[model samples]
Target: MTLRVYLFVFKSRGYIHIVNIFNQMSSDGVTKYKYEYIIVGAGTAGQTIAAGLPSKDVLILEAGGYTTSLLDIPILTPILQKSDFDWSYETVPQPNSCLGLRQQRSRWPMGKGYGGSQILNNMIWNVGHHEDYRGWFSPEEDYNYERDILPYFRESEAEHQPTILKHRTKLAEAFMNATKEYGYDDSFKVPHLTQRNGKRWNMAHENHENNLSHHLVLNAFVMHLLFDRTSINRVTGLVYEKNGFEFEILATKGVILSAGAIGTPLILLSSGIGPKKELINTTVTFRKDLPVGHNLQDHVTTGLDLILLNDTLGMRPWEVFTLNSFYQYFVNGDGPLTMNGCEVVGFLNSTNKSKNWDLGFMVLPIGASADAGIHFKQILNIKDNTWSQYFDPLTSQQSVSILPILLHPKSRGQITLKDDVILIDPKYLTHEDDVDLIVTGIRIIEQLIEMPSMRRLGAELNPKPFPGCENYEFASNAYWKCYVRHLTLTAFHPVGTCKMGSSDDQSSVVNREFQVIGIENLFVVDASVMPNLPSGNPNAAVAMLAKKFLSVLLQSHREKPTNYDI
Candidate 1:
């Protein structure tokens, strides 16, 4: 039988639609499909929730177009970093980092397309130390890693090799053995490698390829939440806009906001679900006066660039032979295609007093160009925009950038709305501890470069000239601090704008169950709900949270029917 298909593209607003040949029957004898859940933002957390949920009518609303280009999914991040897929958010003037660089806008690289940030990010899979969670929720709460969250972690992970899996088990055993000997267990199991079939398993593409029954919509921006007052504080539907025209999607059960840190809070504030004083000033009417856009946190990262004498371990052709490797991957599911760049990592404390490291180190096999700063600068539109024009003036030379992250910064920032637009003014390093932590972190990287593995690679520090370093004292702590302030940027782990906590907790926006406190049927299940930033990359934690919250939503559904009048 010959089939007819219709495709629609909205030019002015950038949206596309596909009308299939087969017409499926609905209850009203119409050829349409209705959804039980409508999820907004098909990014990291959004993709997870969509994949984990049971077989139901699910619809995902994303604002960006789709692309399957190899350039869109490059193994080395610099290629993708310069692509148009990144959202590229810039920070307001950070006084601590960038040497008083005005509007030192860092490249946020939130994927504007299908896979979300995972599609555009560095693709590093870090879970951080177990104590990071304990420190955030301990003594007062009954949240235990082994009892509550470990099984979910195991379920979600798909390790690369059996030997690697065995090594993880051995690491756990070693920690236990050390505890028996020293009467104290401080170390925790590192995160299982997040590779699928030897390739970086972007959750969006994974779902689309594996789960054919699911519906994944790209370039559909959710503009507002549709509420039914008769249902008593429940979100019955959603009002989304595509190509300048608004459409309503009725959800039989719930609407899940799995949009990441920035998107989630911005949606809430735009939907009139934020601080009373702030909402009253804007055109959006007040729905809930909760702290929707407060408690912003992100890991501050600074890079120590080192020039390598030999081609021992810096961007080699074998490391990122994309086209050939991808062809091999599709045929046999093996090769360099499976690697996520960051192979080895270490978590250590800069000071001897702390048990866990507030600083992290990621080892990249290849060195980037000295002009690497140009990629970040262009992506964020730093020069043409309001931000200061600061780029590495040095000529293009091969150098490895050792990224040191300030894991537990004391400084806090906020995301507020002005004239209905999302304004991210992350007041980075306003506190003395944040500055000190970053400084100490720089010292730690200096020590790591002295390691046998790095030394063998002939890694020599790049003595690049900076504004205040006229003396060229490379080893001096003062010189290092000057460099850190000028180079430090976000680790791409912005979180906690819509924190989850108890009612009395003034900083809390959502509750323990991930529901917005004041708003009925409104819940946030993304990185924004985190009370604090984790000590490492947040991708794993964000996915784990989505799984945990899915269970919570299901249990709540089972215990209490949605039809019941509250």
Candidate 2:
């Protein structure tokens, strides 16, 4: 059992050997360490880069703990989010959106363990649109969607398209058929994700064996990024806390923050590289005037529930308590264990003419098991009355749901420093136009249910009025608009805090190559670097983003070996 350890490369008799160190040590009781690359956040993007980066001199600092073998089962994801695997972040109360939710605050749950959200996310694999790829990067940057990124998307997926789902439901079929009238061909086009058979095949799946550098540290919380006092903008070291002990590790090449949208921006602001106004109250000395926490974008949705013909008899209650279910999963790698919440998706643009991959409006299925209502209330922190009205019925009496999502919202929010955690002000439904667009989307869903195929399946809108919307009739457009506001929920897709663009763009935080503006040896390579949020779920896109950055990093290193320096 040979363990690949990371310290530094040494040439002995014309051979490079990696020396394993329990901890870099000296008689001083504390050890000083240096790596070529230090990546913050062992989330989806961080692990991807750490697994593929050519250099063995890399260290990944994950704020949370390690990902255990339990993450391999898809259904256990819900349980994981409530456990220590989650960062357990909640947003500040919103004045506009989430009027029906508890305290009107959106709870932002991010995976804190090694695999990040990939271990806990609803496993849906989607490579957004061609225009989305162009939109996400700066115009001057040559990011070839087909040549560079698309192939990687294909490389990672073992896609089980919605049409072939073995556990297909009648409601899902009806949803697919109903959308055809509105020019949506495949309402049943949900794409299964980073899984092979029934197990999760995330970016961190094979990482244990092949990671060239075993420099990955879990249970390690990065307190602050250390820079040379001699060169204020030149990032040179990282200060992190692990097991109640703190240490500073040096970096020779650079530091990358793939710590996710929320975690990344907070680190940047704390490191004194965000907007001057934002850092005014913080103790961090302002390093650059970049808008590190502005342009925060997320995909919000308005849900429309339904009552299935079988009276929810066919619903697979999110059950994991039995030995039979465990035996079924362990022996065959199939059954309820393989299900990743929802099993179908219907992606659409407003015009109803864009390519299938393009995003605009999504009528996606959010699997409604018997126990799902309980999970939603706990995970989303829904109010008791709100739960009784909206989701509680879906428990045993009703099942299957389609949420009309606001794919691109004009509304923007900001992330600021809290005492320890980051403050997320999603400002959901703040933009008037965003609310209007989603109303139009719900109308389409209302019409879709009227289609003969859907109607035959008894797929009718749940008649109960939402808790606060007792004034308007459920059938009216005005009622739906109010519904959108009351039930506004994120697709859990957040991006664009550290936007990428050329220096000419004042709002830009990082350049096309993903380098921070005015800061040397500092880069951000996660969803936060997206100039624009893609029109679809961003898990797969985040992985591709890591691949693209790794290619760039490697290529740049080859082109100018010793020049990626301050």
Candidate 3:
């Protein structure tokens, strides 16, 4: 017998569609239908929330399509980034960095499909310092935020304790073992392999299974939030389009905008919930005008590329495409299938006198200058000739890249509307202090590379020919600074667009509870609400926030008395 389950209808770009699924039961006569939850975007944070939520209905509205090929996994991220799955966003050319660099495209790899950017990202998991979050609220507070959040981090991780390698020929295993032994494991926990029995564990699939009460509709793009000003001034529902038709989804309880930093603010500004002056000046109907798209923040990453004496540490072409590898993945669910491009990470302050590590770095065993944009385009089949523009033989190479990331940038940018369309000016490196932090970070990495442990592995300095240095002065602080400005890019951890704080804080867009000040039943739960960028990767923090919000929701539900008499 065949069973049909009806899910909600949603809009995408400019289309509308009603989604449903049909299931065929087995001979045992036991069958279960998935729940539905309307989740927008299947990126890192989105997928984490979907996977962790309790069993209920889930409906994910993704503007992108689905992934069916192994090429979509993290191992092939360098190649997959050039495809259509990536938004391929380019920043307005700045006078500071990428001076000689072409077009200044930021290479915003927001995956357009089920797995979101997780499918195309470097996949390095680094949770920021505990003090980073608590510091934002109050510098005097001694609360153990790390202890509170560590459990949430552990909940998401699937640890692997393998024996240390001794004179191993396998590059992947050696890299993992070396990182574990070199004090890297004690700094922060690595993310559990997102593969289920060898296959990529697309969070959309897991979230759907856990949350059966809600429905996830792929290829659905939300355009605006429908608000009811006549009653309670609360958000009523969302209006979206899919398949060239428009439809409205009415929310009974509340409207939670879990869209990432970029998409969340874009949707709000489009719905007339931004700065009042801007909305009144535009064609949009004004609502709150509460600075919805202000204070944009992102981590700026600069790298030092070092050529290794041995090529044994990187992936071979045969490893990428071989019958033996595929058989191992499909049958035993092992081999290179479990690898997530980035395997080692470190977080430390550029200056030891600082409160905590402001500088963060991740180790990638492959070439540093691979075309991140072109890599995504090929995977999603987005036709474009721009791939050749950024490809340069001299700059790109097959060597391990050590990236130094500035966690707390004093420089802040903004997102505004141009004829009601999203326009972002990341405004990277605007402040001298921000630039100094990044410059100091590069010097730190240089020291790390020259350490006894790393040098023993035969690490070589990058930019074989320094622009302003003599042959012997390759690794000077000044030379590193020049290279950093030209090569540094966003870490893709944009936040603070809709900051959270007390009502008195002018910079705050939402309260500590994540509720928008002027509106009821409306909350911002993604990275956009971060008052400041964390010291490391923001994905784990985003997941922890989701769990924290759910806990508050459950506690509130239990406290309220239910009335049975009608």
Q: Which model scores highest in TM-score?
A: 2
RMSD of each: 8.2, 8.9, 8.5
**Model 3 segments beyond 4 Å from truth?**
1-39, 42-60, 69-72, 135-142, 146-193, 209-211, 308-310, 314-319, 369-398, 466-474, 560-566
Q: Lowest lDDT 10-mer window, candidate 1?
A: 1-10
Going through the candidates in order, what is the number of backbone clashes in each? 9, 0, 59
Q: Residue 127 CA error for candidate 1 (Å)?
A: 2.4
Model 1 misplaced regions, further than 4 Å: 1-34, 69-76, 100-102, 135-141, 158-193, 230-232, 304-339, 352-355, 366-377, 380-396, 468-474, 564-566
Give a tens-digit lDDT track for model 2, residues 1-566.
00110110112101211111112221121233877888888767887788777777788777665555555777656656555667777888999889877899877778876677776787677777666777444353676777755876664443222122334445666666667755665544755566666777666666765644547676676777788778787888778877568898888898999889888888888888888876777777778888988999998886735333443424344333356767867888766667666666666666656553323444323433345454556776677887876676665555556776777777999888855457899889888988887887767767877888777766677777778888998768778778778877777889999998877789999887788888878889889988777766888788778877887788888898853432
Q: Residue 560, candidate 3: how far off, in angstroms? A: 4.6
Q: In candidate 2, which residue pairs clash?
A: none
lDDT of each: 0.61, 0.70, 0.59
TM-score pick, better of 1 and 3: 1
